[model samples]
Target chain A: MRATTIHAPGDIRVSEVPDPTITAPTDAIVKVTAGCICGSDLWPYRGENPITEGDTIGHECVGVVEEVGSEVHSFKPGDFVVVPFCHSDNTCAHCLHGAHSVCTNLGMTVSGQAEYALVTQAEGSLVKLDEMPDASMIPSLLALSDVMPTGWHAAVCAGVPEGGTVVVVGDGAVGLCGVLAASVMGAEKVIVMSRHEPRQRIATAFGATHVVAARGREGAAEVKEITDGVGADAVLECVGTDAAMGTAFAVARPGSMVGFVGVPHGVQLPVQKMFQKNVGLRGGMAPVRRYLPELLDLVTSGSIEPGLVFDSTLPLDQVADGYRAMDERRAIKVMLDLQG
Target chain B: MRATTIHAPGDIRVSEVPDPTITAPTDAIVKVTAGCICGSDLWPYRGENPITEGDTIGHECVGVVEEVGSEVHSFKPGDFVVVPFCHSDNTCAHCLHGAHSVCTNLGMTVSGQAEYALVTQAEGSLVKLDEMPDASMIPSLLALSDVMPTGWHAAVCAGVPEGGTVVVVGDGAVGLCGVLAASVMGAEKVIVMSRHEPRQRIATAFGATHVVAARGREGAAEVKEITDGVGADAVLECVGTDAAMGTAFAVARPGSMVGFVGVPHGVQLPVQKMFQKNVGLRGGMAPVRRYLPELLDLVTSGSIEPGLVFDSTLPLDQVADGYRAMDERRAIKVMLDLQG
Candidate 1:
């Protein structure tokens, strides 16, 4: 099977690798129809995150089930499924408590950017479509595996109240999806902190009523002004950098929450300010499996077009170019056509 | 007029001071029936917090309204009222949003440990009782001014669900009050971390189902053991020290929230661990004015006896003894007899 592998920072390749097979009774193999690169993937590509010499990368995919183990009950061969970035047994304590990302039997999808991927705990983590949809729906469906659901997690954690104002502090695919989620959840005003025009257009289309291109305190000031000096009712922190974290807290009003999804690095939480203003911090790697079903419904119904974030697409064999585009900021997110 | 003043760290004295008068249209002077020493008051007494040579210091009191400014409407001259530690207009943006502690017109109670105290924002900050109750209920009413409502804020911010398990990481008056709040919020299991037999008894009386006397990781382990390897459904960080914060997060389950009320000092937020567990941190200085009405109803209806936390009582002239007793942990809380 041909799969995407990283040899080192800036060295992504697509080559023939050993095929993934059912190693456990709860596992299933899926022929991936499509996959996409995530903002997190750039961490290793940029050497910010340590990586092994060659490891299969990518955690987002929509695919057709090829085979399943005896114990897998929810999915079987020939079924179209959306695989969550993290697989979990829904019966586990954490999963039942709606913390599937930390499920007792939790693990990640294997070889997701390959022709075929192995999904563990398939009974709980894979969401099967009732029937096949148009080929064009693949990108949006694929998004549910990670970005869409992740974005929804941010909004949910931030507690975006109906008719309230929301600030999304990032311009990545997930951030754009956060704007969409806040809109869907009925935020009257959605503010996006983005400097790029292309991403700003997508944000506007996704229901962002304002865009503040300023960085740091300047951006926060603009949001506060828009919110009539009260700051945002909810803040979605899609970027994990220290500056982004600072900005998220800065624009949050008293009693509001800052929902962060980006993996934080070297960020110091503003405890005193948080304590004084009654602001809260909540978020992490999203429980994608828990949120996938609802978001899938909205995608299939055409209420949202999250696939718009896939500004660049390429064949699976051209995986290196995909990484480059995303790494160099030439693309918001890159979709890989496994079928091609 | 006589008032409690802090001369320096560990030095408190009750001496002659200029009598407080109505200074604003929103001001109301109260003839204090009872005033209490809060855990926070000990901060300056212990030399942990800086104190000026002579500053009037108490913020919790219940009294009869002796005078009101022209603009005061909700409170009358003869009404018995609960003076919240933080005065709020209850009409500002933050107040309307349920964050009264950060109200635009917010201030602190003035000279509450004296015969007469000045309460700003009288129409909004003071909750007038329908009728003056017996002297026995005065202490309980005073508790509502700070500790009880502060505890309720912790439970509310932690998002305590019906029939959930709750852990309170302190055994002070506020934490005991938290046990009561969690129980009232429908938690099936209430755990308090306490080492003192006296405070533990108060916790059990306040609806604590379990008491773990261990500190730090050991305390967290006991909580987890009691929870059957899972952590508490909700945790209240009533102690603001780093150890208490650590134990609160350590014993919390994934997807659970830790509501912190103690004034956090020298604490480092466990952002990475919090992210990985999907545990959230939310809380701060409580908005007492926002929660006063319901809590006052509970206190007055005999459904709750938060006054049980006041194990010691003293005359107004014994204010120095009250400070020493509290600083030495000789009492759970001290109630000053302002009218004696």
Candidate 2:
């Protein structure tokens, strides 16, 4: 098997790796169909996070179940599925409450950027599509594995409702998808704050009623101006920076909600301001598993096409180019065709 | 008329001031019967906040309406009323949505320390007591103006449910009252985190099932241990401090709520931890007007006694002593006798 391995910052390569096999009674072997580079991947790739000598990377994928362990009952051989980044037991109290991201028995068993990966807690981690998807549906289906679910989590956690005005803070793929989620959830006005023209176009296509190419206070002010000085009813913060968090607070109307999905990068919420503005902050590692069912339905029904975020695609062996293109801001998202 | 004023840090004095008169068409003049010192007052009194010149202080009171402006329809002369801290018009969109504290008009007519107060939006700010109360009930009635309602807001915002475990992060007057609020709201386990014996005693009397003296991480651990490692379902942060805010987050279960009422003092929320925990944070200046009517019913029926928070009393001429006692932690709250 071959996988994308990270040996150091800015250094990525596709190298030979041992094939995955059933290691637990609940584990299943999956042959990767399509995978992608995620924004979170950039953390370790930039050397900002601790990286080992040869760590296999990737946590998003659309794959086919090639084999299953004795305890796997819900899935069988040769079923195409979308796998959430986080693995859960599906029977724990937390999972029962639909908070699979915080499942009591959680694991990262599948490396998405590979030909074959092991998936633990098979019944809970894999969502089998009703039918085999066309090759063109691969990227969009793969998106449900993480990005789409993540964006939906941001909107749902913030309680975005019909006729509400929603503000999205980042221009990344997840942020763009949040605009799509808020729109799908019935938000009347979807505002995306981005300076990038390509991402702005994707956001608009996803139902963004307005786009503001400003940052910080100016950007927040722009959102307020657009909302008739009441600020946004819901804010989705996908950029986990101090500036991004500040914008999230500044642009929320009194009693509004801000859902943050980006990993914090030295950002702390201003409690005093949050209290004064009566803004509610709910976010963290999105429980993407919680939204997979509905998100997959929407994708299959053609109500949304989140895969439009993938501006560039490459073969599994060319994973390095996908990283380079995204690293250079040349692509909103990069798709890797593992089937080839 | 005379009012209590703070000329500088630690300098409180009772001095003659012009009698309040209606300044707006919706304003009314009230002859104050009771006004109590709030924990928030200690901020400016202890130099935590700047006291510029002789600024009149206090924001809680019950009084008799002496005069009403032409636009005032719901209240009139000779009516006994409980005045909310914020003077909201109640006609604005925000007020109509139940966010009276952040109303668009007349949000800052603070003259609660004087013998007579100019209350803006008389119809909205004054809640008429069903009947005039005896002198002994004045203290409890005055509480309905702020502390009691603020405490109720904290519990309600935290979403404390029946049979739920709730952790209160402050032990001041508001925190103590929050215990009563949680109990009334049917919380099964009300745990108060307080090291002060006085406040703890009050919390216990108000129905705190468990008390933890530890603070910050240690306090959170104690709460988790008591909750069987699941953490409290709701947390009321009645104290406005970084340590208190941190404990509120650390002690809550995932998918729970944290309602904070303490005016934030240099506190910053841990966004990453909050997100991962799936905690919902909601709080701010409480819309006391919204809760006063119901709380007044509870008080009038002899079902609750929020007045016990006032541990001391002083004549209007001894206003300086009242401030010193509260600032020096000798009193949880002080009641002022205006006629003396």
Give the candidate number with the greatest TM-score. 1
- Per-residue lDDT tens digits of candidate 2, residues B100-196? 8878874554667779888888888789976678888888898888899899999988988999899998899999989999999999999999999
Best by DockQ: 1
Model 1 steric clash total: 0
How far does residue B27 in candidate 1 sit from its true spot (Å)?
Answer: 1.0
Task: Name the lDDT of candidate 2.
Answer: 0.86
- Candidate 1 structure quality by residue, lDDT tens digits, A1-340: 9999999999999978899988999999999999999999999999999988779999999999999999997787889999999999999889999999999998897588889999988998999998886898988998899998888999999999999999999999999999999999999999999999999999999999999999988888898899999999999999899899999999999999999998998889989999999999999999998888788889999998899999988999888999999988999999999887
Worst 10 residues of 1 chain B by lDDT: B106-115
How far residue B269's Cα lies from its native spot in candidate 2, in Å, is: 2.5
True contacts kept of each: 0.73, 0.65
Per-residue lDDT of A1-340 in model 2, one digit per residue for the tens?
8999999998999888888888889998888899899998988888888888677999888889999999999899889998888888878866776678878888774478999878888888788977789988888998988898888888987789799899999989999999999999899999999999989999999999999998888888788899988888889999788899899889988877888888888887787788877788887776767788888888888888999988988998888888888888888899998867
DockQ score for candidate 2: 0.64
TM-score per candidate, chains pooled? 0.98, 0.95
Judged by DockQ cut-offs, is candidate 2 incorrect, acceptable, medium or high?
A: medium
